[model samples]
Target chain A: MIPAGPAGAHVRHWQRFTFTERVMRSLFYIVVLIGIVWSLQSIEIIPEFLYDAPQQTADLFVRMWPIDWGWYPKVVHAALMETLHTATLGTILAVAMATPVALLVARNVTRSVLLNSIGRFILVATRSVHAMIWALFFVAVFGPGALAGTLAIAVHSIGFTGKFLSEAIEEAKPGPIEALKAAGAPPLAVLIKGIWPQVKPAFLALAMFRWDINVRESAVLGLVGGGGLGMALDTALSNLYWDQAGLVLAVIFGIVIVAEIATSWARSRII
Target chain B: MDASAPIKPPVDDAGVDRTLIIRSLTKAYRAGQPVLKNVSLKVEGRGMTAIIGPSGTGKSTLIRCINRLVDPTAGEILFLDQDIAKLNGRALRQMRRRIGMVFQEYNLVERLSVIENVLTGRLGYVPVWRAWLRRFKARDIERAFQLLDAVGLGALATQRADQLSGGQRQRVGIARALMQEPDLILADEPTSSLDPKTSVEIMELIAKRAGERDIPVIVNIHNVALARRFADRVVGMSKGEIVFDGPPRDLEDSHLLQIYGGEGWLE
Candidate 1:
């Protein structure tokens, strides 16, 4: 029994979760723990390899030390150029392709439910498949070159760019659009003048972000014959040239850092 | 043939047929719940007619119905020799351009330059490519600058709309509305967002500019004092119906009580 102090208050209690909710959350954690243990038991890790991992890493680093500096001008240079070209060209092409799809996906822009669904389906299909798998497919069709790599990156990026762009478009303020409509501007004019200006900052930021990601992802596309730095690394590993592999890895790490810095600067400037 | 024959519009002292006649206009956002009910009124060709009412009394719906922004569920709105309720597509757009509206929020595109937002008023007259390229005709550009000067925002023409204060933004909104070279102006609570002094100034600017051009204005306002000071006539609304309509000199405490209902705040 609780003592009543005020007319409207007998007992005032608050909680983040109900009793049943807490119990369910505990059960979920328990199930997750059991699943992790089951997975560990099924994999049957070899204790010898696990224990030797640190030493093996140290040995690999020792072999990779004093990397092949001469390899930079010979094999890595052309492959690095090819990788950059693949990413840049793919991003440009994706921008061209994704703009229309983003328009279709934005509910305020495209009114038809069926068209929105189709646009969503396209985004899901492109994004669900990994860029490497796309590279493999394009390699089969195009017979392995920068073209296949470029195509793979472009197709995979359409979903990422389109999804974000459509969201930006949807988030644009409705007030200006309504004002333009009241002014009797045509539908296309409304979009170009009213909606486009509002979403321009977000659109530019998204493009820069996606391009940054594409640079990193396209680096590995050459492993599947997509023609980039990964091809050079693959060749070096097969021949057991740790020095050349080390050069490739160092170049990739440097390029990624550079790309990140450049994109972040550009994003700041744009917004 | 009679139906097709054009009827001559009734011209007042302003020598323009800016007459707006609404007959039984009704709007129901849903099936049996109406926001506006059987409203009928006639506006003259010149001077400000203020519609004063409490919030949610459909003053906005009444004004929006004139531009067909909110589609009316029933009745005929007769303006410029055509029934506004019956227009669609290109016809409706053409009609809307002739009537300028100022919003309570002063909804100028914030990212655009103040002058560019003013030029948007000419969108209905210009081609789409010209708008896209920002290659507005020389006359329109000149006129936009003149309007900015008229609104006392001449120096701020190049600035972005978001950088403006609330009053300045509303001034830009007025300039944009005037840029349409409209026959009629509908101001739905234009001064509601500004301070007391700014509110009086905005009302003065609207009255002066629209009066100079003989463009009749219909303003919806909450401040009865501002309405009385600027509006030649006042129409009062309560619960989706016009409860009173008369000259401001004739409005009294009795009418205010009827319009706002249960108001100790009328002092």
Candidate 2:
């Protein structure tokens, strides 16, 4: 028999390079090229602007710094509550609507391919429109209030929550459902007993996650006249009350932090 | 020793009075590729009737057809004189309450407590609101506890299903089935996931309890030895058709070869 070292070398010589390694190298080069392009675009080093450039942005930031400090308390109390209310209403309505829609969208759960396709199309339509644009549309219809913001957030969240919930439902073990069916349980019973148990925790966790995101989105809905803390922030900025705007920013930051912590705690308990 | 002994049969033959009848049952997932073709069999009201078959031979499909899990494309399934194939919605659910099923994987709701998982068997009997609220009647809870005790899982009532060992989970699964107070128990590869020792123990428990209750069991199994050990009658399937139907003693090596299609492994 040949020595172990020479035998290993012979084996190595016979082995061909894998397709995966070649693909990985190509991907690395493409990623580096894209990063360089993005960096150059971000710094405006390519002379792409036509008017009112990055200097205007810096000027606006400087002009919006010193806000009206005395207006802080009122702004924080009222606007903060509105933001929370929008998030609460939006998340609740979104979760309720998405629950049924997700059942339709999930391939394993939905028996009809046509229905599943329709459900997926609806989700795509809802998600393609950003929350801000949805807020603008709702403002056009509902005339600028928390209702508009709530509707905006609800529509956007339905897309996100429906997709996530459907994925969770699809990935659940098929064994329990089969067992239920064999036990002579009806379709609805199988869904309740087998599917619901597997998906409930994930659905709850997703709802909590959406609530946190909705709070942040609700704060900005006022910028598009959909009504919330964003309206106050926009007003302060337009009037050059930089100190009051600064205070509002601080309050929004605090609310986001608190919402994050609460959502995280709730998620931990559930999963 | 007396306490551990299997329950003795009473004079009343309530279990023997019931029967399941199937006539020309046929199931096709697609237009032409039938999983069960013109299959017809009857199960006696008591004792274990094991269905032995190779993989992809429609053994599961046959059991599923009995409960209408996969709707038969043609023919009739009569359970206690009712045309079970025609049942829909509430009628089907009510019928299902009396037919319990045990799975290969011990399909307990993993996040639920063993007792809570067992309580689900009562879903067909309990009102929807009651099930939602988990407010099963006091009698039902008592019965659930009793069944848990009978299945030897009394102490594991509060434990999450995923925490239990495979044998322990199967015990809980049996208890859950018993909680339904079903007239028939259908076990689909119930011991396929277990080791030989555990499989024997589980099969013994299933056979003993089912016998005591006088409830008939239609078990789909791959192991010929286990089937011979426990089953009163064996039904062998090959390529979606029943090739042999007889007592274990009558199931000769030639029949096994005919059913499974090779004699190389019989040695």
Candidate 3:
């Protein structure tokens, strides 16, 4: 209702937040500040190490000034290829595994509450554990090979890919599905002709994005004894070959940039 | 309105019982409050039957109930020698194949090409693998294109459904409905989203095409004038009950007042 002032004068009043809301917001900000201060007090810092951090960083960079380009042909080349394969294969595996999980998780697609919960459980379980931790677990099982890295990437990606794909499925317009159902199309037919077409672009775009992220994640998998360029870097660092380690870092950085650019371009084309 | 007049069911030239009988149909989304209150309607074998009423009068619900899209809480929907309300699973799907439906929003799959959307009408009849492979039968493809041509959309066969204008999408929707080789058609507010000119054109297309095929069409329409122009029979509903049932020429202003509950909008 519009409020009127005395003597029939027009009165307009607008505030984004009510007084109670403003008070609650102020309380929230104070609590956040207290939490930050409490956390700062808990994590102890060494004053000597903190003071010389810049100097230490400069010394390390100086030791790695001359990158050993010669290391590329001997070891980095094969490891780089292995990293790409892990990312690519892992993504394909993740997409394949996540498709059914996504279907189950989407409320519109799977009406059963039990199935949705199971799907949700799987998504949360796979996603809660970081890729590096997953790599360590798989490396223990697979004995520190490329298989471990691929498995790690795929498992970690299931939660991400399935979540997005299920969201896409749920967001699909129901009009076409209803139209097809009215035409007496079978359940499978409706899914193919109605839902698939609607979600295909989003599916492809998400898959590409997952693959891009997987590439970067897979690159570091070897640090945990899963196979990739990180293994080569591990070897160089263990052997005190700073120049070789620098070359591996440079290569990884370059490849990540390339993967980002390529995936963005491909996503644009698909969407 | 002499609404107590008995409806004489008509048979088509093929001697098929195309009459759709609804007896005391009632629907309640919630337990006690009914959206349709003991509604009953009879759609004869041929020509257009328009259900006209104000919004939320169960016009759309009544049409959907015939094909079992919206299940009636109580009543019988007798069509084609079967009780549509009781059919389940495969039996229900088989019954639905003979009934085609058009929508207010022209619900074509937005990413699918025009011809594919039209072919969706055949998805019920074709094998699932055929739809998956885009390997529809030769005759079905020919007929889809022919129907598209009939709707003046032959040139836009390969275009995505989302790329078309509202009128064009509704044309595709009509073509898709016709492609089913249906015995009956149900259209729920098919032209409510179109402009006046396009609305008229769409109504004309529905009437003409269904007329040529001798298929009975029950359309839920808000535009009383379009219903009068295109429908052979008019069913006026108010508060979930059939208030008037007669020919378009006999739909007087008094009937409109009774159905819509206001004399102000009559002008």
Candidate 4:
């Protein structure tokens, strides 16, 4: 009460400035810098050649219009099916491989520090190479086919699925595990009864999410000779058949949307 | 209260004496610092033995060590003439299946139905493929139903565990433990999360079940009143060491003061 004056007001002002005001100012500067960088990139000022690339892009888009409704049925029935099959086979193989690797990577489950570290490093190595690059490498090794694409997607999915599964396993409640141990449940029994129950919903959700992403990625893997709809789209684009390219893009988009909806519905039912 | 007063029932003395003999037990989380320091205490084969102490006194560690959950750094935990402390892998798992534990939080898998959680108690007994298939033996299922009924949770068996009240979940937890047909029951602060009334009910259930089965029970409890109310024998721990062991009737206010340290909380 004695210090309820201008001096106290000054102290309160400084306190406000040090915490809230300073943070606001820092955020403002970061936003402004990001905006500037984005503007430069968008206008192609940063990459001179991009600035001169508009005429070609516009021509491509103009040629893409004038609907290819005649071929829509075939694209949906065949190409979309191929895409789904690639995603399904890829995700199934990945989930199978990831299951054991995830257990080894999880620090809580693994017990051995060296083993967990090694498993994590392997996952990191697998994930480091992008799926498209993996597809290209596999295509070179096995020759251009759906197998190469499937293996590429599976390898990449393994890294992602294993990392997420391990995290889910690690974060599982310790209560059941402890209870299982006290019950004299074997390590395998504990994993089955204690860990699996807690992580099942999350694991399934992650796997579904990976499958959704794989559907989108599998279409792209074909661009690198891993055969699928992306191969059709790439060939159409290369031949300047913009209407066919547009059809392929629409089909890919439709498949992705459908997969996302289906996976989301499935995930909701699990939990 | 006399520190040397007999705690166990007279009939237990003459029967096939089933006692847990813990000798020179020690546990340390870190290399230099020990959580349980050369702790050793015998538990009678029948009735409830409550280990009462203040927080951080290794009460939970001692109970966990009985089934090798905490894994003692040193000592022999001889249960039925077998050194559980030295057992590993399959032997350890076989030993664990014979002992049951209830937790303070109930620890039921929230996503699982109550019946599924109860069946988990039989996981060690059932084959892995059978468990994976959710094909519990008909007898086991019938026994689980009976146990759920005994716990007054038969009606709620189909509900998910997360849907139950705290007291109800603890009841399910009890049913799950009892399903194991354990030789000994370990309850670590099982009722600490419940209201006073619920706590009493849970403790009464634990005491009654253990008594009916003539199974030994080791409970780590912070509430001295609760411990005194249910415990046949009271083992008072302080700073990872047993300071007093005797009948609950013999645990005087002075002993409580020693076990918990300071008399400010005492009425």
Best model number under DockQ? 3
Model 1 per-residue lDDT tens digits across residues A1-271: 6665776566668999999999999999999999999999999999999999999999999999889989999999999999999999999988889999999999999999999999998888998999999999999999898999999999999999999999999999888888888888889889999999999999889888888998998888988998989899899889999999999999999999999999999988988
Reference-based lDDT, residue B246, model 1? 97
In model 1, the clashing pairs are none
Candidate 4 residues B1-267, lDDT tens each? Answer: 233555444324334346788999989988868888898777768889999999999999999888887889999999855899999888888888888889998888787899988888887788887877889999989988998898888899899899999999988888888889877889999999999999999999999877887888889999989999999999999988999999999999999989988888997
Complex DockQ, candidate 3: 0.74
- Candidate 4 chain A least-lDDT 10 residues: A7-16
C-alpha lDDT values of all predictions: 0.92, 0.85, 0.93, 0.86
Q: Model 2: runs farther than 4 Å from truth?
A: A1-69, B1-16
Better of 1 and 3 by lDDT: 3
Best by lDDT: 3
Ranking by DockQ: 3, 1, 4, 2
TM-score of model 3's chain A: 0.91
How much is B179 displaced in model 4, in angstroms? 1.9
Candidate 3 structure quality by residue, lDDT tens digits, B126-244: 99999999999999999999999999999999999999999999999999999999999999999999999999999999999999999999999999999999999999999999999
List the candidate 3 regions with Cα displacement exceeding 4 Å.
A1-34, B1-15
Clashing pairs in 4: A183-B96, A184-B96, A184-B97
Model 2's chain B TM-score? 0.93
Worst 10 residues of 2 chain A by lDDT: A6-15
Task: Give per-model TM-scores.
Answer: 0.94, 0.84, 0.93, 0.87
User: In terms of TM-score, how similar is model 4 to the real structure?
Assistant: 0.87
Task: Encode model 3's per-residue lDDT on A1-271: one tens digit a residue.
Answer: 5457777767678999999999999999999999999997889778899999999999889988899999899999999999999999999999999999999999998999999999999999999999999999998898997999999999999999999999999999999999999999999998899999999999999999998999999988999988989899999999999999999999999999999999999988887
Question: Model 2: per-residue lDDT, tens digit, B1-267?
Answer: 134444333212442245788889888999899988899897767789999989999999888777777788998988755888898877887778878988889988887788988888887777666776778899999998888898888998899899999999998888878878888898989999999999999999999888888888999999999999999999999998999999999999998998898778999
Instruction: Give lDDT tens digits, candidate 4, residues A1-271.
Output: 4576776764433354777879999999999999999997787654566676898788777888874767767653565677778888999999999889999999889889999988888789889899999998999999997899999999988889999999999999998788777666667877887898889999999999999999999987778888888888888779888898888888888888898899999999987
Give the TM-score between model 3's chain B and the true chain B.
0.95
Please give the lDDT score at residue B115 for candidate 3.
97
